[model samples]
Target: MPTLFSKYAYYFNQLCEFSPNRLQAQKAKNVAPVRYPTPVQKNMNLMVDFKVENKVIGYSLASKQHAHGNCLVHFQSTINRILKPDSFVVPRETVAISICNSFFTLGSSPTDFVKTKQGGKPLPEDSYFTYKMVTKHVMIVLYNSEGAEEQLAGFVYYPQLLTSRRVCPNIDETAMALARITYSSDNGPEMFARFCKKTQRDVIVKIMNGGMSATHMDYNYILLEQNYGSCSECNAFHQEKMKKEKKEKKKSITEKAASKSKSKSEAATATETANSTVTPPPKTAPPKAVDSDDEYDFGN
Candidate 1:
């Protein structure tokens, strides 16, 4: 019989094999209802809370850049929320979710965000955080060496992608970020599935209600949701709003231009009309001086 310690070690190894893998979650074969491809908002800061030793910390991550991303709130709060810094390492499940969320929310980029918006080169797998850009979206996921357990933590599905160089949850760091998703979660697979479903739905509804935009890569997204992706309308609301805003802006500009042109034309016409109506002063000869001198001579 294997000792509990050995059993845990084996479990940890298996769990690490699939921790928050985006590659498997977003396979091209699984597409869903997508009017267009979602835009990548890579390097955006995510909200995360963690339990270290016996203390808990929260932070607004700008990706795992860690250079200047640590939040005082996280450091202080985490110290209290998690085990104290002096305490030993905490369980992986306790750390993964919070850390993953923090990294995902960050939107920092090596270059200008413009390139990241178009799917830029990703960081290495060994990198603290990788920017996984696919379609028009970006997310981040991290790997942990210890403490992954199906009891409380979940397994991650990672896929080797061949098509686009980008995926979701920052899988492209190693090769391609296809889509990182949880394996078997403890709260019952169905429950976790439902949770994911709800999350996707909520995000889609949020986007749609907020008015998202359509993109050129819609068809591909629908293709992936079949196996790797979910067809949640995360940004639908935003899409509509964006399109509406764009149209309104264009309309407003056109109207303003028309008004300006009309005013300009009216002013020009007024100038021309004034010039045509006015007559130049008759060229009055310089006869006044001569007439004065003649009058004086007559008197003399």
Candidate 2:
């Protein structure tokens, strides 16, 4: 078996011989090195073991060799990899909490979170878990267990969490609690709202009112406003209600104006009718003839 160092040395020698500089020098000298059909003729089935501190951690198999100009390159695919001893593996709970914190700090959407879990892409440190938007206002996190099974890691009720700045505890119990609440219900936001109303109302109100560090609370509100117009479900609901009331109030104003105009029109019509029906005083000649007849009867 070739040692890892020996294999590396062989590849390095092959690369140097066919390097661009070497090719240029050969062309200048009018001397061409013998060309081979492929980069490496022998050791095509080469396997190199990766070791750390005398222990094999992983291995790579040379799949194929190709020629790039004058350089012979072997492409190797790593297999059965293991983390090095000094590698820092973040705990699943910590990853879940970091994701929740990112919502506040980065204003990252659920879609952004999901993109990080995509295969063949290098996942960012903050995006180890998968984000699933279970509802408009609710999201959940998932992680792969040791058995390679997807398991629920945590949940994020964005509206409440963003508004209250309350993150889930970095414990399995928190995930369990969230799972229990959301297991069978689709109305996640409403259910979460009810839960908060029953148990966390005071804490939420305190946070919202700057009972926490006022400066920190203000900063969060600024970010919330910039990212999502209204941070809380309560605020969104109130905004909708206000809009409805405004519409009703406007409709009432228009109706009152219409009624006033109609009343004015009817009053004008009545006035005109009274004036048209009025008759001039009875002719004066008739009154004069009655007076002369009455005077003659009195004299008699």
Candidate 3:
């Protein structure tokens, strides 16, 4: 039996040699779609995928080499590897949070996260993430809503035990709570909004009161919600929302200008008509002199 490392190495060999079928997505150019590996190949790669907030985050890789942690980082200095800075690259901090979110949510022992779970039918997860369970552990319970007749989806876990939930508790709570409310009909938007506000207030206050040396878990609005949304994609969502609002405001201003222009035109037209009606109109030019019959005709 190949060791995990050996198996990954084998998969990596395949990934390196793996060529995707070319697809002609656009015309007018000699271009084809890059073929992706079979599901089997992708799944095999996911064996080491990382998790965040019960979400799997796939890091765009420079190669098919199976790697985790710093080994898995996006760019390779030695390899002269590069990715578009704007590419969907996640920050290291965000990556860390994503893993924490998943580990704690499952209540899986940190040790399990660290070691591979053989014959374990792992839950369906994102393809981008892998988990490593450490031996030490601490459990923290965060609620979507607690002491409510219908408790919304919340999280419970220990950071020393799990990495995914450690970085961003608020974000995950907000997301899961909303999901439960939306799909399950167990909670509502209002419930979520309230929960978010209260929870944010609580967490923020705790952080503030704790002084500057607050625990990583105690502060960072972003870290708090990393599980809910901290990855680059989630941040994009936030940015897009702001852009939409700005567009709407600009549209409103344009509409107002158009409306004002129309009003001004109408008023000017009305004033012109009033002036013509009220004030004497300029006298029409005197009728052109009749060809002066009286003016001597030369041959008369």
Candidate 4:
């Protein structure tokens, strides 16, 4: 019997040799599509195709590879290398929380059984999304439960799938359901918001309390959030301090000018007083001396 690694190696070889027809034909013969209708898109049924080596062992979805995460791509690229071919596979259980425009599915398979009957009437025009519109984003995370601890299986994200929930007024419940998926765990927009709150609060609290020892902070966790950079209290405090400094500076300048003016006035007043008090030289002293000389000359 070929091991799972051997089978994956064969698949990779097949991928390199790339024949669309051969791959599809092989898949069609070896795999069967299960009738699983996704809640987001009623028209499109979710299909699971399992790989067989003498018997069913592994399952995968034929999904387009994305730069972000995609479970199918990761499963083909990495997960198959680790798991035993004979280990029973199951989907991970996901908690439902309200997240706008997104939803999560446990495992590669869906649990709810929505049936299709033969000769069924066509669904109403409003029952699904139109061909032109796209609405929902999906994140598929896979886990290997065969081990003592559940290990990460693979990661996949689907962006902009059109659904009736997004298009019409009727699928409110569907939209609500997808929104109910928890955003705390995944590193999506919601998780980023959470990160922003945590980091912002920590940084603000530290700075306000005068803890500046941590010069280099891990700010990669920052993306976007409300009241992050523009903290109201911080802004107000700084503004008040700046205003106080400006007022003190102005006061000092005014006081210096007043003192200078007073000193100049006092010097001018002293100069005027000295000039007014100066008496003319005693004019009579010379006349008296001349009179005395004349009297002495007569006597001689």
lDDT of each: 0.31, 0.32, 0.31, 0.31
lDDT of 2 by residue, 190-217 (tens): 2221212222221111112322111110
For model 4, the stretches where C-alpha displacement exceeds 4 angstroms are 1-228, 284-300
lDDT of 4 by residue, 1-300 (tens): 479887677556544433323322322112322223233332123323423222222222223321222222332332244334533332221111111111222232322111122266642332211110112322222221232322122222232122211111111122111222221233232111111233332222113334212111222211211122444454444456557878999999999999999999999999999999998986554534456676677655
Best by lDDT: 2
What RMSD does model 1 have?
20.3
Higher-scoring candidate on lDDT, 2 or 3 = 2
Look at candidate 3 and tell me the lDDT of residue 263: 100
TM-score of each: 0.25, 0.22, 0.21, 0.21
Give candidate 3 misplaced runs (Cα > 4 Å): 1-229, 279-300
Candidate 3 per-residue lDDT over residues 122-189, each given as its tens digit: 63342222211111111122222123232111222221112222222233233333333333343321
For every candidate, C-alpha RMSD to the true structure in Å = 20.3, 27.5, 23.0, 29.1
Give the per-residue Cα lDDT of candidate 4 at 37: 26
Clashing pairs in 2: none
lDDT tens digits, residues 1-300, model 1?
469787677556534543334333443223332322222222222214322221122222232332111222222333354334432322221212122221122222211011111146563443222123232222223322224321101111122112323233222221211232232222221111211332332111112222333211111122222232334442343345567879999999999999999999999999999999998888966755557676677655
lDDT of 2: 0.32
Global CA lDDT computed for model 1: 0.31
